[model samples]
Target: MKLKQLSVALFTAATLTAGSNSKADTITTPEVITKTTSAFFNCADYEVVGVCFWLYCTITGCTVKTSAKVAHYNPEITTQTYRNAEKPPWVETRVMLDAMQAGHDGSLIGIILETMGSGLDELGGGAGSENKAASHSNMTFTLTDSFGNPVLLASKVIGSSGYVCDPQLTPMYPYYVSNLDTVAWRFSIPEMFYPQSLNPFGSLLGSNSYNWGGYYPRIGHVTNHDLVKESGLIAFRSAHFLSRRGESHVYTTIAQNSREGFWPPGPLTEHSGKWQQLAPKGETSCKTFPLSAGTGPSDGLSGYRSDDGAHVWNLWRRYKCCKDRGDFLYDIEW
Candidate 1:
């Protein structure tokens, strides 16, 4: 049983009873962080699969299919910094929508977008050039009702300032996003196991190189080539591991260009040494460094050394860098 199939089955059983309010209208579980769990399913078990708003929903009997958009945030930088000092020069926000399915069992859909409004004014000065509007990212979950109408399940707001490290400005103390709120309703699915299933409702897909917090040197590298050039070295890989516990982390490798071939491979050359270092070889911990325009001290090294001199490597947790024109590699191990 794949996650999508299980979700559809649960949805069908829950809604089978006729009533003025659909079973989905009410959440039986309390809204607590611990209550959220990853649901699994097998696509081979279902005849049809659908996704919406990054939520995977599958139907065994119905043919209705829907698409969804997974929103993303675009941050504008006025200036760039490699350290925790300078303030970011300019800031802007953009949104992206991706396709999703609604049938995945125990699957959840959410959106992330950077927004500007009164929320910025509350930070300090009124909306002015000097006091640019504070940017926000909103993650929303969506689902379909008994009638198959697309509906929003839940939403949460996150601030941009806290996540990025600036070189100049004093670090904002206790960085926090002020209007923190959660949607009253959330989608629910059945419990099942599914593998190699297409989760249209979730933003991260096998085709995408970057995971939740893992960074990619460029965007197009994972989704398309054109966008690759526009992507900056991963400032940081988002903490996807924590968000989706129990779910196996997937890593994809890119072929090394001629320039990359010249560099000495790291200890984990078998698995793209650089990626192993960033993601690590085990389930305990995974971390990657911030990427800069030029190579740093750790440039070109095939493996990463822990503080104790332990060399741990894996392709899934590696990162690559470039010098004048050659290739450099870095690994993340714990």
Candidate 2:
């Protein structure tokens, strides 16, 4: 089925099973893979942005070839944040991460991990972890990623495979883990002292301060009264950190420059990109954080907050690309 259709089908199925007594503590790999089919693919977002003209050089003469430049958002990274590193909501590697935590504790010399495994989730504030937050703070951010998404794999088998774009990052891998960077993530290092961090208008999450909160310091701890907004701010902070290139953050940049046949997305900024919730109940559609009042699901709704204080979201950014049809890209026409 088409990706858009798959979303409809999944929602229908979820509605039918809404009454089931069984519940999931954390989002599972199988569940993620299943939700990806529909969550990643959105026919409405996919569009022909422009046309690319390429020079096809031959032995005798050269000809210009044209290709359609298509633009759409790809669910590139699975960003997750939770209170505990050992019990990440992503179930596939929960036990393994727990074992690593144990090993770190038992070693005689104390083998502090320079780098953890790729499957590990972002270590949000926990009981004894570095990110532990004050009681008044509703939550802390621990941004992490399980690399590339499986939606690309699913798209290859689907009938609309031609529309799919190659992922810039590897699949099922960890590109960024907040726990590793203590100075920057915890104290916000120099970022907190920067003018932007000090200014309320700088790096604002929504249109105004009333929406969510400022994005400075890029720390995980949030004192917002609403749980849903807090989760959204944490997700936004992580995305902001990853979207740009900086030595402060231990992460790979998701921003890509436009090239000849491939036009990738640039740095993520508020209002420029959208988010799709993937855990504590997956969402079928995408929306901005601190969604406008009276919009879909808001902070007033119940159950959006995860029981374990773990939340996962897929960052969707726009990209444009065209199939290579000639020797060199000559020009682009709108």
Candidate 3:
């Protein structure tokens, strides 16, 4: 009955693998990079935006060099939320945190804020402290080649397309770390004092009353009962803060105006970018927030909350660029 036994084993494996919300705890750096890069290719959102012209010169004469300008979304950030800051579920972030600790031990101000802001740091869900769950988050740049593709995927893209330009920011950098920015992230500081934060029409994600939970005052604390939605809000808040400049955060601006030969993405606007679930479970496709933001056995989003309230999402942003052809940019035929 050896063949029969093999068949039974295969059936069992298929049963386990067939689910929308199947999950894993932590995602390694290689998996994150590979999956995201593969998703980039699968997206099929690349387009020819315009034609760029450059002035090419030779000893004999000068000529106009032309190339196709293309635009597509890039997985520029890996945003995650979890209860603990000392050890996140992201492999790369954990490694970076260790190195940061080794180099600087801990910031004196950070230690002070952590102590003074103990219970107030993250408000938990449910009544009383028994069901309480605290959350912290990080927004970090994804690892990519100079041209914005993952190292392994870069070769394939370059081989196929011939050329691609670099992104505005370098890869593998942390844009926002909740624990490191306590005054603003934990306490909300002047953000709470802002007029829009208090207004009914401004500074909110989804709505406070729609059972989706409110996302204003953009801090690490919330009173929602749903763990998944809470984590989603935390991630969304991180994205919102990183999109624009002049917020109460230490973030590199992602906004750029189109220049001569190169064209970069502008500031991130709500509903423009999309999120792909990376941990707990993974999705082959990505969609805008709230629409694809549900999780669990009842929901269709296909991922469940982690045991420690940890979650990861790949944030994809649109970018347009063209290869530098010659000495100076001549014109863009849009």
Candidate with the greatest TM-score versus the true structure: 2
Candidates' C-alpha lDDT: 0.18, 0.62, 0.58
Candidate 2, 52: how far from true, in Å? Answer: 0.7
Write the number of the candidate with greater lDDT, choosing between 1 and 2.
2
lDDT of 2 by residue, 93-134 (tens): 444344323433433212323232223233346432344555
lDDT of 3: 0.58
lDDT of 3 by residue, 180-228 (tens): 5556665678778777678745644554444344456777766565656
My TM-score estimates for the predictions, one after another, are: 0.16, 0.77, 0.74
List the candidate numbers ranked by lDDT, top first. 2, 3, 1
Identify the leading candidate in terms of lDDT. Answer: 2
Off by over 4 Å in 3: 1-23, 99-110, 114-163, 207-214, 292-297, 302-304, 327-334
In model 2, which runs have C-alpha deviations exceeding 4 angstroms? 1-23, 41-44, 95-146, 154-162, 294-300
Model 1 lDDT-worst window of ten: 89-98
